[model samples]
Target: MEESTADLIRAQLRRLRSAAGLNQEEFGKLVHYSASMVSAVETGTRPYDRPLLARADEVLASGGLLVSLLRIAEREGQPSWFLPWLDAERLARQLRVFQPTLIPALLQTEGYARAVIRCDDLLSDEEVERRVAARLDRQAILAQPDPPQLIAVVDEAVLHRRDERFRALMVHQVEHLIACAERPNVSIHVIPLSVGLHIGLSGPFSLARGADGGWVAIMENQLTASPTDGEADLATLSARWETVRNEALSRQQSVELLKEVVKSWP
Candidate 1:
């Protein structure tokens, strides 16, 4: 959670404790918290420390429910707003990412990501660096010994043209894609321009296999992101994705396409 949101949760905890008619010292004792620690949480000086949050959940008769919800916010390096989604994604067994306009973030090389970041009109160099760090941190998941299976579908256009420096970076990205595709856990698909209109016209979305083997669909538009965990909605998105997959070029064809584009680079 963002520091501010964490503060707010702490405030709520204080209120909840008060509502149960427990003084700071008494509540701290019940939750294994020091009186000063409780005071710190109440005043927003500290976030919901894990142990305290768990014990407090029980003391407040919440049956440990809030503990699970709050732990998602505790994951380090997650953006305050994106924490919940990150929590959901982190638990996924497989990831299906479709990028209609650009390269998939997880598969991007640092050079490619930096090149993409340079196109942002709003970010200062420092801000871009911060975002880059966060993105790279996310990419670290791909390096795990038993990382989730990743199926990335991208438009062939991303392989062909871009600014000159980005062209070099794109070459590296293509090479990386080829390497990753060779791995048992990764699959790369290319949607050709010849395929024409399809469900992807609605734009990019990520399909994740949840902890319970359910599907979670996540879409980010111009300014907002939405995640639909409903099975019905996910089923519809899965159908759409299947169409796009069928329309896309085969893996061998995509590799050949990348080779052709790399040969044409200036």
Candidate 2:
């Protein structure tokens, strides 16, 4: 198999770091990242973004070689609108998500992700596969040594998806959710159907608090998604998040609910 542009970049980074006589720990300090993050990038477990690449280029005196490679890799996948949100997500210290109609992208199983992407119908099979791969790649953040706190509030209806054709897939997805919820950095809460209608019905959105303490948010619609750091937007979404979270079942209750819902999938 041919190596992807991303793979090539990772290999080059690893080679360059070694030539600089810097171990992952020593190099990461210069780049302002954790050693584990440097290892993740070199090992192809995490996607390299522009900032990280640029910093590495300067730190290693690569004369912009790393950043140049990243430009090529960025063109290979991911939509333009999603790029900002993706960067924010990677740098976030805390992520708060509200999903009314489906599982949050970060927590979706591969099968569920493919199904959701395929719903577009307009996309070719190649595009669908590319998107699924990108979505799965985004999940690597959860495994980082210093992962962001991910608090997700989902509508109970998302788990009770009634498509018979997807029954088994949904079961596996819910089981994946149960496993994710067990992680200390992850919290999954479900808003019961008993709540009837609520503010979360507006749409799905996410807020990410970066390491610098600044917050940014992404609002998703059927056609596209956009990210914002404006005060007004943040304020409104923050209020909605608080309201939806309040309506959600406790974490323990949500996990129990997930277990029960899995049994109902058949």
Every model's Cα RMSD, please?
Answer: 9.4, 6.9
Q: After superposition, how far is residue 192 of candidate 1 from its true place, in Å?
A: 1.4
Q: Candidate 1's residue-wise lDDT over 102-134, tens digit each?
A: 888888888878878878888899878877776
- Single out the weakest 10-residue window by summed lDDT for candidate 2: 1-10
TM-score for candidate 1, please give it.
0.71
Q: Which stretch of 10 consecutive residues in model 1 shows the poorest summed lDDT?
A: 76-85
Task: Give me the runs in candidate 2 sitting further than 4 Å from their true place.
Answer: 1-74
Off by over 4 Å in 1: 1-81
Q: How accurate locally, in lDDT, is each candidate?
A: 0.73, 0.86
Count the clashes in each prediction: 0, 0
